[model samples]
Target chain A: MNLFKIVTKNMRQRALATTLTGISVALAVALTVAIVHIKRGMQQRFEQSTLGYEMVIGAKGSPLQLVLNTVFNLDISPGNIPWTLVEKLQADRRVKAAVPFSVGDNYRGFRIIGTTGAFGETFGYKLAEGRWFTCSIEALRDAFKEALEHSQERIAKEKGDAPAKPAAHHHNAAEAVIGATVAQETGLRVGQKFIAAHGVEVSPNAEEHTDNPWTITGILAPTGTAVDRGLYINLDSFYHIEGHEVRDAPKDNDPDPGQVSAIALKLRSPIHAFPIYREINDGEEAMAAFPAVEVRKLFAIVGNIDRILLAQAILIGLVAGVAIAVSIYNSMSERRREIAILRALGARRGTIFAIVVLEAVAICAAGAVAGVAGGHLIVMVANAALRHVSGFTVAPLTMEVAELWVVAGSVALGALAGIGPAWRAYRTEVAENLAPTS
Target chain B: MNDAVLSLREVRKSYREADGNRLDVIQVGQFELAAGDQIALVGSSGSGKSTLLNLIAGILLPDAGVVCVNGTDITQLPEAKRDRFRAGNIGYVFQSFNLLQGFTALENVRLGQMFGNGTGDAVELLKKVDLAHRLHHKPRALSVGEQQRVAIARALVNAPALVLADEPTGSLDAANGTAVLELLRQVCTEGRHTLLMVTHDPAVMRHFERVVRLEELR
Candidate 1:
């Protein structure tokens, strides 16, 4: 009896067109929602991971690579910088903490990073269970000396020279602290032992270090960041692995047989950052990069792709609007008699026009509401793939204010699309159309 | 005349032929229908009997003249006001029973009541037409007799002062047509509403006490 009822009747009368157009709107909205959600989530996770890591110093190469490698446990490390650079940054007055990391191993595809006990304390990371792995400056220095001797003996044997008899070495039990996700995935408890794969990612032919198995001494609490996906081992134990021998040339008297993949720096004050960055970049030893700035730059590049995706979504929406317009306009031919009947029954031309317009609006409004729900469902399903690619998943159920605007925009689009058809209905000749056809 | 429920003065209607000549459809000097009058205006095919009914219902505006219904000149009213006036004062029934196919019988009658702002019970009106059990049936599902009865219920739902029936029984078989015509006339007589029915059927014309030819009105 109401205009709304009339519109529902009209829409029900054209259910196929209604459903098809509605699905098109839902498709556009779903894609847009997924894009916006994943973008926001990745940006937030990247920013959060960079919180304690004000600066990352690595081998002279892409700064984004260094941040991704050091802070996010993503992309492979560019190369190693000499350990003397870590010592220098640690001793600097402007540096509050400088934690070195070495990577070249994985346990079932989760990266195994060798770092000091200071990593957890410096970054405010907490142990969920058990204890930190045994790691100290003295142990690191002694391990470096042993690695230098091992390399020297290899060089002598390769050169067909008489190799000196190696001194007796004390075997230290290698220990590791697993990340939350690492523990959950590998089912590694405090007392469990795990051997490392020789590469960052799992490969069928990847070599496993069965000889250098590490005991899990601790598990980290979930920080909702890249830390959850990393396995931390003692830096001293890292040098004891055969392939991880020091690459520096031995000086014999003061053999600098130590190198690290990356060093994360926490500045005493942000004002001292640029000077320290310049100091590191100026030296041939390493390059210094701000993690936050690098993250922003990375997303800035990604934003263009997001914009293109958003443009496609908008284009779909516009096409849907036009389809609605064309569809309702086409239906006006069949509706002339109905319109004439309504007019003959004392309904005004304006009332007939409103009925046509309201029908379109109702269709879009229904589609938009269904689209929002379908969008959230897309987000939920996409989160698994997102976690695989980025170690982060956007919260699917969280609503954005922009979604309200999306619904409103679709309703407005419906109204605009209805204008031509409504005008056609308004201008229909009542008396002529009402005449019975054979 | 003072108590007339329907009045027409100097009413003229015309259409331009496809070949550019003007064709006059209706030219009536003056006509009046008193309250409760059941008059049949008979005309042959294409004689503009339907056109005259449309003019009275305010569905088609006269090219020249005044159309007064219930003492108010509907021709002088704006299109919107005239529509509202038509809804309140005039009821129209077409030969084909133009009920919206999407709606049930009850909803179709309520649709008329909605535009007229009438508070009459639509169920009561359908019950009067002996369609109480068929209130939920769509036009296509109903027999021709039931469809015309639904149309009659819709026309009188607002209890308007004048009812216009253009070949109201034209599309039905004789048996159903006679039954629908009697039901329509009974309802109109009971409500004391003035009825102006257009028909070419002699059987239908005999049912009316007063039959006016379209030419005689001109």
Candidate 2:
């Protein structure tokens, strides 16, 4: 019989053990594949979530927190700097574009960012269904009307939204431009008006801007990550909705005056980020945060988790290797007579050795087949689920160069497993084995 | 002296006991067989008769001696060369029939042929064995007499210059054993190939042209 037929027949005879070994290899392979997919997914998300500004300028706080508040719409502001200081930074020769953002308002948990046209361009944000506002008055009407539409649509959709429109408008009254997730989640439509609800209950008077309604004018495109949760507006619209101008109106009509939360600065080069950030934050009241640096730090914080999972994969792979070894070791006992027969039939020791070792290779190949199949199945299921839930598609477990190394490594392990018993068979004495004791 | 197909010169072999003393299996001895010769080695238990056959087949190395098969000094050749030489010129039939379990009788015979024999026409060899009908039958399905016949066909398929049969009919009944032994003698006679058979049955030895009896190992 051919070597492949012999090995497969043997495995079929011991059906249960072979299946158990195959499944063991499969489980190990599945775990490795899943962990690798997650790591890659997180890396891409982390990078996308930090795109836009070359440098973020704020009050003296953690650079990471400054980036989180301004770029990611998470945590608190880096504390505010005076409006005049932002004006000076905006005037700098290296600054190509600048947009100020004042955070702290939330419409059903999506952060409201009061910004300018430069902010939309800075984040590469484009209207999936509507247009961007250019003038200050247009920005104000856009923010106010959009917020109302967002809240109203969320309630009407009965999925995610604000309660009935609030009564008063304050610092939180600025309009809301729905993120792609918010629009899809709440089924919001353009022109709907809604309130910007506050989430920080610790500050009961913190976001009392219900009187200023924001109308939903546009929805942003999905960027595959957290940006799908962002809300946009303009700085002057926020102050107008907050009644800051209404209460202290001058005798004559004039432009609304107030300080923005912070200004996002874009530099000429990514390499210029650190130097410009250091210069901006050095001895000044305002601090500058680099998105790239903060993302790198975040990656460093969670780097060991991936390594731990990888270590577990290696451990399971080793265990599967041992199971393969035991299979060969046990088979040697059953095949002793057959081996002796072959020897008597003129098979040299080397031929016997080759056949036994080939059996081991055949078994490992079975394990590899099982592992790759099981691993692919898990990746496919994960991809389908992620696509449905987050609208972000996960790439299937690719047969990378590294995986080839793993297969070669397992084959080497299989060889080691068979060497002991196959060598014993090779050295057997044909005369003694075939001698008639009776 | 006339082109001895198989020869042994001063062959010796021994086994070591747990107590460090030696139990000699076979002392130094010499023997030779010519083409068309039918010889039987008859002995009691543990008489080293099988060891001599193994030496001739190049399956075992004598402690000290020379073995030549088909005029080539097999004992002096390296292990690989010796195996090649054996596969090229020597064929063996064991008492157990020694057919691979998973393969059919014909496949077993073909396997033997592949290792340097059976390079010629296969249909001719099947016709000679008279096993043409039973070619597809596995060893387990075949009766003891039938299995022995298959083994004989395998040994002769390569058309080796010499054939070694160890108790080829040991497991058969009277009629079957006689039929198998007669088949072996008739095939070797027709092909002019040398036959060296080791057996315990005196009745079977009568068919041999020469009979060598060993009282003890030497």
Candidate 3:
């Protein structure tokens, strides 16, 4: 019989120990593999969500909060910056494109953002159906002019210095473009209309823009970003809403209409990013945040969590290796006579050593295979759940180079663990063990 | 002397006792066995019969002298070379029939030829031992006599010049012992292989063509 057959037969002789040891190794590997997959998925999602935007300019606050609010739509914005600042940034030669976003409203749980057509173009969003809102400068100017004329006519008719009623004016219908996830969750098709709430929370007493209902002009395709969970409306319509109008006296640098939550800036050249960031942050009106920098800080915190989990996985693998060593060492005592018999039958010390080592390697190899498969299965299930809940999808079963290294390292650990027992088998004296009593 | 298939000269072996004292196990000045000769070595319980068998099989290196098998001194070779030389030239049958437990009778016989210079059919060897019917049976499934028969088949499968049998019938009953001894003699004579066996029973020693007492050899 071949050495492999003999080794396998010996392992089969102690089936319970072999299987238990393999299971320990498998559990360790599965945990490590799953953790790595999740870490990689999160990193990729963070990177993709902030693609193209170099900096976010918003009211002076936490840069990370500004990024979270504007880029990921994860937190409440720290109030708003003047729209005049956005106009000034748009006029700058260093700024390639300055897309303004007006936030602080929601439809269901999804954020409703007021932006121009340039926002969609700048973010590389494609429409699944219908068309983008007709948000040109001409449209905004004409709508503003019509509102001003109606306000004047109302003031003249009421002679007693009363507040101009916006309800009396017949303005153009405000248009809205919905994201793939927003459309799916709300079941709002093109040509349907929905009113916006004043804030993100769903409450019975929350104020709604009942008179300024918006028509769904388009639905964006899935982009696997925060944009996929937002509702987009024209900036002009956003300011015209009842509660959104600027009531305080306008500052010298503030726009006459109102404020925008944040301005997403694309640089003319990547080299100008730092310079422009410094210039914007140095200004009193706004704070500038590099999305990549803020995201890196965020991931550093996440990376610590990953490190702790990775350490636990490594500890588990080491314990599994020890388990294999202990189990094999325990069996060595019982197999002393068998090893002596092999030595008596012309088998060398090296042969016996190789057989024992091969047994350990086989167990680890089998365990690693099962673990990788089990890990991917977990990722697949988690991906489905995450997609359903948050509209964020991570591709499952992606085998990274680090995982391959882990597999190789696990096999090496198995071999190393077997060395002690193999040495014991190698040092077995044939004459002593072959005694009749033994 | 020229035709001697197995020979030993000034071979001595010792072990350290638990009390830090040296104990001489075996010390033989001279020994020789001619090709195809069948002999029994009679010894007491502590006479180091097993140690002598190990020396002849090159399983243990002598503390001081040469163990020559088929004209080559095995003591001069390295441990690895000695193992290879022993596998090719010498065969051994243990007192308790040291057959591998998990392997079938046929496979056990084949295992003997694994490191040998030439391969032989294990089934044919089993047939030579009259164990053809039990070729697929493991050692646990065989009777003492039947297991000994399989061990004898394994020893002869490599076509060695000399076979060492250490208390070959020590565990068998008288009837089974006589049958197994006769089978070993008949096969060795037919195959022209020399047999050196260790035993304490006079009745079993009578089956050999010649006998040597361990006290005299020492």
Candidate 4:
């Protein structure tokens, strides 16, 4: 009896067209929503992961690759820096804390990072199960001296000379702390022991360091960052593994020849960051980069692809709008009799016009609601691939204010698309159209 | 004529042919029907019988005259006002029934009532037309006679001062047509509403006490 009832009846009469057109709108909206949502989610996650890391020092290479390797645990390290530089940074008055990490192995696809006992405390990572593993500067220096002796023996043996017996390095127990996801996926508990496999990624042909097994000492709480996906082990225990000797042996009475993949620095003051970054990058041994700036540059390059995808989604939305207009416009001819009948029942022309427009709006409004839900589902499914690629997954359930604008834009699109057909219904001649057609 | 429920004077309507010739359809100088009167208006096909009815309902405007339902000159009102005026003051029944196919019988009647601000009970009116059992049936599901009966109930829903029916039973069989005609005349008499029905069939004219030819009105 009401105008809404009339519009509903009209939509029901043409249910197939209504449904097909509605799904098209939903498809466009879902794509647009997923793109906007994932882009923002991933950017937030990437940026949030860099919060405490003021600067990262690595081998001279792409600053982006260094950040990706150090901050996110994705991509291979550019190269290595000497452990003396780590000791130097640690001794600096301007440097607050310098946590060095050496990466060259994995256990069941999860990377095993060799770091000091200060790592968890420096990064504010909380333990969920056991205490942190024991490591000290003295144990690390002994491991380095022992590695140097081994390198010398290998060199003497290669030259057909009887090699000197290398001094055995005295180090702490080979203990490890596991990230939340690593422990869950590997089922490695606090007392469990696991062997390291050569290389940072999983491979069947990769050699396993079976002779040097590290016992798990702790499991970290879920941080919703790359920290949740790693297996950290004592750096001194890492040096005891075979084939880990420093390749570039230092001369007698030289500084420690030990090498590490990278060092993450926390500044003593905000003002000290620029001077220290310039000082490190100016040197020939290593390069320093701000993790935050490198991430911005990376996404700036990646933002182009995001823009292109968003444009395609918008184009699809425009096509859907046109399809709605054409579908309803074509229906006006068949509905002239119905419109005339309503007129004969004394419905105003404006009322008839509103009915047609409302029908279009109803179709789109329904599609938009369904599209928002579908968009969230797309994010939930995409989180797996995102995790595998970046070692970080965006939070899937959080809603953005832009989603409200998307729904509103869709409703406005429906209104624009309905105008042409509504005008046709308004102009129908009551007397000429009242008669029945064959 | 002051008590006349329907009146038309010096009314003229014409259409322009594809060749640009003006073809006159209605040229009635005077016509008046009092309240409670039941009159059958007869004309040959294409002789403007429905045209005059449309003019009276304000569904079509005459080229040059006034159509008064009660005392208001509908031709003087703007198109929107005329539309509102028609909703409350007039009722129309078409030959083809003109029922929306998607709506049930009761819904169709309710649609009519919605526009005219009617207060009558649609179910009771359908029951009066012997369609209480078929109230929920859509037009496609109803027999032709039942559809015409629903149309009749819709026309009287607003209790208009003037009711115009153009071939109300033209699509029905002889027996159903007679029953529909009896129901229409009985309802008009009971409600004290004036009825003007247009049809070429003499069988339909026989039911009315006063029959007017289109030529005589002109």
**Each model's Cα RMSD:** 1.9, 7.2, 4.3, 1.8
Position A174, candidate 3: lDDT: 92
Cα lDDT of model 4 by residue, A1-438, tens digit? 798898889999999999998998898888888989998998888998898999999999999999999988889999999998998999999998999999889988788999997789888999999989999889999988888888888888888999998776577899999999999888899999999999988898999999999999999999887888999999998888878887755588777879999999998899999999999999999999999999999899889999999899888888988999999999999999999989888888998889989988988888888888888899999989988888777677788898888889889999999999999999999999999778
Candidate 3 residue lDDT tens string, A195-305: 988896556778988988999999999887878889999977876665564434333342244468999998889998888888888989899998989989999998999
Residue-wise lDDT of candidate 1 within B153-201, one digit each (tens)? 9899889999999898999999999999999999999999899999999
Docking class of 4: high
Ranking by DockQ: 4, 1, 3, 2
Off by over 4 Å in 2: A1-16, A48-53, A57-62, A65-89, A100-115, A123-264, A283-286, A380-393, A435-438, B17-21, B102-146, B182-192, B206-210, B215-218
Which ten-residue region of model 3 chain A has the weakest summed lDDT?
A: A246-255
Candidate rank order under TM-score: 4, 1, 3, 2
TM-score for model 4? Answer: 0.96
Q: In candidate 2, what are the lDDT values of residues B1-218, reduced to their tens digit?
A: 34899887788878899999998877647788888889898887668777778888888888898788878888899877777778778878888887776777877777776665457555566667787788888888988888888888888877899999988888888899899999989988998989999998888888776888864324
Best by DockQ: 4
Q: Write the per-residue lDDT of candidate 2 for residues A1-438, one digit (tens) a residue.
A: 344554565566667876776667666766776666656675676677766667778878788888867776667775666555556767877777777777667766567777776767776777788766433644454444444434444445564544565444333334457789878877876787767755412244556566767777788887776667766765656545432322222222323233556788876666766677678767666877778788888777767887898789878877976786687678666667767666666667888787667666666666766766666677677876764443354557556555566567666766776677678778777766764334
How many clashes (backbone N, Cα, C below 3 Å) per candidate? 0, 28, 0, 0
Return the lDDT, model 2, position B199: 90
Q: Higher TM-score: candidate 1 or 2?
A: 1
Task: Report DockQ per prediction, comma-separated.
Answer: 0.77, 0.42, 0.58, 0.81
Candidate 1 Cα misplacement greater than 4 A, ranges = A168-173
Docking class of 1: medium
Worst 10 residues of 2 chain A by lDDT: A245-254
